[model samples]
Target: MMGRTIFIDPGRCIGCQACVSACRECDSHRGKSMIHLDYPDEGRSVASLPTVCMHCEDPVAPCAEVCPADAILVTPDGVVQQADTTRCIGCANCVNACPFGVPKIDLQAKLQMKCNLCYDRTAYGLAPMCATVCPTGALFYGTVEELRAERPGVQVADSFTFGTTTVSTGVAMVVPADKVQWPVPGGLPVVEINGKDVR
Candidate 1:
């Protein structure tokens, strides 16, 4: 899976929760789903976005950097893995440091968990479970060229600017063909839906 990566298209998501369910089936985090469905406007609308680890690249993964116990690990392919249960101190440093807000601290288990892109399967040349079950193609796994050929009207983006800090990631986001970066106002993370940007 050298060049393959997960592509998220929020506009196409149907909020079916298929990805979340499938994620839990992975061997790494059995019985617990690392993927989260975020409803930007909970009461008003059903518009939901699937949130997964971006696997930060520019600063080399803030989650891994702030891990005092060195529980977090990054693969050579740039997939930021979930924390090591044996080493994790349950300090929530990675959870707070992640700009995408993907990590979850299991208080009872006292462990940090997040998506590893299903490394157990991906390493064997298989698509991630979440991407495999996504009905709306909101979460897809493939190379950039494959995505471009499959959906020519959209473009892929991997870099995002949060406040003044710009971060690149292993996963790519499928955005409108005309734009690459959607500026975040006041440093708050924003998500694009129906061609409009929203927080």
Candidate 2:
């Protein structure tokens, strides 16, 4: 459904970058990927987090609020469109304003690039490329209610406080259980990779 929201379950991510690759297939972004795969801490563990535009629901998104040229637009469905090429001045205000760090300024094109949630596909009742190709079900395509029903232990939060203002987003983040205890020592268990033990 066009109204369906995206859910990200960081626990299920495997650092494969399939979502990142699929994002590049969107026609709107062409060869550039709007999704970013991040390793919050490499030394602690190998877990990864795939981040897309949170599609903030603030009446005036931080990016749009900071854009001097008014190039960024938030649609009725809460999808944040890429900055208009004609109006965008390659200024990094949008990039700096985003709390999730989703927006990027294209130096060559002089425009801001960010995930539009595969509008072309979602508008047609199709899944976004990233959600479609995610093997771990980390990048989910469903409603907030559905995600909550299926994952009772995880809390879904759409609003976050950045400094003084609170920003609401269309996308929901699946928060892991508080004070989660891992069975393995130091979070990651020593495992054998090939013929040697990896610790």
Candidate 3:
């Protein structure tokens, strides 16, 4: 069965950390927040990048491949799950192998922690806690058809390249419809500000 997926638009994030707080309230996580809210650039704090587990589809999953105990598994519906603590030996292999840096080993619990897309809730046709409490519409949970209709000008891409390997992710990103031209000039005009021209 195809399940509802989560989508993120970093531009819409205000760094309020409501998603992070909500993630902690997930019953499956045991008071741990799986989501990581970060500033992509320390100097440029205009936007926040919320890091999530991008359940890779193609190339299978790197975390699953490197697991010696078969701890990490991707569900049929494409949710890359947190490690099975019973089988997991706290080897930290999954922490190093994931391209998106999604998994982290809990030193105290000796287990891995990461986002499972709120499987406990999504399995019941309910949205994840993070998506449900987002103050700004930055985080969302919906069908692909609904996303396409909601964001007509953005392309949803799930694939990315890390080193020589191409990883396919289940979560899609909203990219501009037109190919991006980088190194574009800043939006500041050349004018005398305090007797100095701002470049």
Candidate 4:
């Protein structure tokens, strides 16, 4: 199954809430609003980047492991998905479980919420609304394999931040061969170096 991940560059994000508005407008979501505009900082009102469910590929996903209600599941493509609210008791165990803090609670439905990566839109052969609406060409959408093939030598700041990530986050980001800041943690890691997978 194609994971249908949404990729965004924080440095590149223009802080447009188009993705947020589109998710609500699409209206496939039955229980809760799927996406939200997020801010990395609170003091100065900086360019808050858009963040949603990461859909991690790890076998021991934090959300699924911690959910008392088993509200979250990992798809083959590594997308984290929320379970049906009918089975959900609104305990918020999953909400606390995410290290990245992606899940949101729907005050009206009294259920937890996160993005499904616009399964409906992709099904109809359209780009994710936010990626489409990005005026700065910051946010990107594609397969992990595809991204790796395109960019190399970039490093993840978070992987280094947390002891060692088991390829913890699989989504690959591109930094120009002559760029300033790396995407995730620091610089982009080369998925393949010299036409060979880095060991």
Candidate 5:
């Protein structure tokens, strides 16, 4: 059973960086989390993926399998967290194994860390702080099946309204369009107008 996969709709990220603060709000994700922003885009309202540990379906746990210390452990909810402290030699092997680059070595703490996904909040049926703090209602949370079910035929997005306008004026844009195509990359919605994939 997949607990809840954290969904990142880049069209919703305004580059506000508020989620960074949200990660630090509680002890769950407070200490040197693996979650991080990457390679800032030059375009206004540039889209960025908050990359972190995307727990895989494979049997060989990538990070844990690579770790000599056996530092990574997969939780019941599918969140992989640090498991072994005594065995950790801080070789940074697991850090490199993560494809999303979700593991970080806390130089201060001298251990690897990443986002715990606010285990405490999710236990009570509350949204994670980052999703809650998202001003644009973009960083949403829910079961994958539920989220996929919620928008089956919902028109995804309208082409004329959000399609060209936001891209035209230049984007200090709040709530960036998913993309110009009805489905850009993440299988989300975007509108294609004229020559541009105006999102």
Candidate 6:
């Protein structure tokens, strides 16, 4: 099977929040949006970057590694899932361990919540809700070849470096054609968009 995954193109984002709205409609999200948009420069630019679970691959999942409750699950296909509510103890370990800063502690539910790439839909061979509704194709769900064919000038990068630690992820980011590995200054976990960094 050709591997299908989400590819994020920060440059293509229009701050429309369509992806966020679509994420909220997913049944697993329970009416809450797992995706969020980050404005790299709030006062200067209209450019936005959508944040989703990177689903770290190398070193496995840091969130799951630190979970004493073993609540975080990584699918065979390598998607790092949200905490299992029944097993989660609301410890916030996963939230703190995630380098991408994707996990959130739901106050009311007392559970860690994050994007699972809409596994419920992807498992059935459907595009994720966010990708389906993105007008600009900023969030795309497809094979690597498809992405490369569509955007030949962009580099599909899945490896990021934070100080001395490097992480490989299931999801990829579309960056400048010349760049491949993303390096975070001062070991901070932030995504870069058009040369500006944001979390």
Best by lDDT: 1
Q: Which stretches of candidate 6 lie over 4 Å from their true place?
A: 181-199
List TM-score per model, in order: 0.89, 0.82, 0.84, 0.68, 0.66, 0.89
lDDT of 5: 0.55
TM-score of predicted model 5? Answer: 0.66
lDDT of 1 by residue, 1-199 (tens): 2389899898999899999899999999999999999897888888898988888888899999999999998888888899998999899999998988899998888999999999999999899999999998999899988887888867778887886777778888877766765632223454666659885
lDDT of model 2, residue 81: 89
Q: Lowest-lDDT window of 10 residues in candidate 4? A: 155-164
lDDT tens digits, residues 1-199, model 2?
A: 1259788888899999899888999999888999989897787899898988888776457888899999998788777888988899998899997878899887887888899889899878788999999998898888766666776656666666654556677886666565323211112233655459776
Error (Å) of candidate 2 at residue 131 is: 0.9
lDDT tens per residue, model 5, 81-128: 654666667778877865445677765556776666666787678877
lDDT of 1 at 23: 94
Candidates 3 and 5 compared by lDDT, better number: 3
In the order shown, what is each candidate's alpha-carbon RMSD? Answer: 4.1, 8.0, 7.4, 9.2, 10.3, 4.0
What TM-score, to 2 decimals, does candidate 3 have? 0.84
Clashing pairs in 3: none
Order candidates by TM-score, high to low. Answer: 1, 6, 3, 2, 4, 5
Per-residue C-alpha lDDT of model 6 across residues 86-166, encoded as one tens digit per residue: 999898998888887788897677888899999899989999999999999999899988887887766788887875787
Per-residue CA lDDT of model 4 for 82-157, tens digit only, reads 6567766677777776656677776567677766666567556676666666676455676645445654554222
TM-score (C-alpha, index-matched) for candidate 1: 0.89
True-structure lDDT of candidate 1: 0.86
Better of 3 and 4 by lDDT: 3
Candidate order by lDDT, highest to lowest? Answer: 1, 6, 2, 3, 4, 5
Q: Model 6 residue 143 lDDT?
A: 94
Q: Candidate 6: minimum summed lDDT over ten consecutive residues — where?
A: 181-190
Misplaced by over 4 Å in model 1 are 181-199
